[model samples]
Target: MEETYLSAYVFKYGLEKALKKTGNIEEVTSRMIRDVSGGVRVEDDISPEGLIWIDGDNFNTWLKPKIGQCQADGSFKTVYQAAEHVAPDPYSIYPSSGKCTADGLVGADGKVRKNVI
Candidate 1:
């Protein structure tokens, strides 16, 4: 009912122009990730690094050997850049081998807190 900036843009420029946001990837991502969780503000520092996918399909631990300091640096560079968000299979074939019996989802056992003693 109300004519917003988006509608005006679509009428003036076209749907594609209105629907798309154009900006540098790092700046865009920094804008996107700005918020606080718990007591820590989770905003990303402005940098030129784009989002990268580290292939960790067979690792025994989820984050054992360290990983991607990723960003959304260059998604619009090419159509294939869309694959940055696509994650590979995140489960090891042997789920019960390398660690405790905790299945990896958060709150898996219906308990909110898993006390580490």
Candidate 2:
């Protein structure tokens, strides 16, 4: 008997499609093997962290929600709210009074505070 392995490009294409369909590549990939008879194994040589860099700057908006304010106790707070208005110039040092502060406040010790709002 001979064995064949799927190429990285093919796997990536399948993964992208699965992610688009389920919105979760990891979960979908896991489920796919579970549903198979021989217990198909897919090698994920791609670093989980590296996935963030795939699209780089173009993915900034998609990654923004994941980047949040860290609290002094190491907890995170959501930077944007569904109901609140997002600032047009979040990076501007002198933002408009009504704009939300994009940068989370960090203490002198590099710890974030819970009272950021």
Q: Compute each candidate's TM-score over C-alphas.
A: 0.19, 0.21
Q: In candidate 2, what are the lDDT values of residues 1-117, reduced to their tens digit?
A: 001123343345545656666776556865452222121223336332112111211111111123469999987776753443232343247432232322343445555435545
Which residue segments of model 2 deviate by more than 4 Å?
A: 1-6, 30-117
Off by over 4 Å in 1: 1-45, 51-82, 86-105
Native-referenced Cα lDDT, model 2: 0.37
Task: Pull out the clashing pairs in model 2.
Answer: none
Predicted candidate 1 versus true structure: per-residue lDDT over 1-117, tens digit per residue: 222522332233322232344434333332232211111111123112332222222211111122444458832332133423443343235442233322332334444334533
lDDT of 1: 0.29
Deviation (Å) of 111 in candidate 2: 62
Clashes of 1: 3
> In order, what lDDT does every prediction score?
0.29, 0.37
Clashing pairs in 1: 50-71, 50-73, 51-71
Alpha-carbon error at 37 in model 2, in Å?
16
TM-score (C-alpha, index-matched) for candidate 1: 0.19
- The lowest-lDDT stretch of 10 consecutive residues in candidate 1 is 35-44
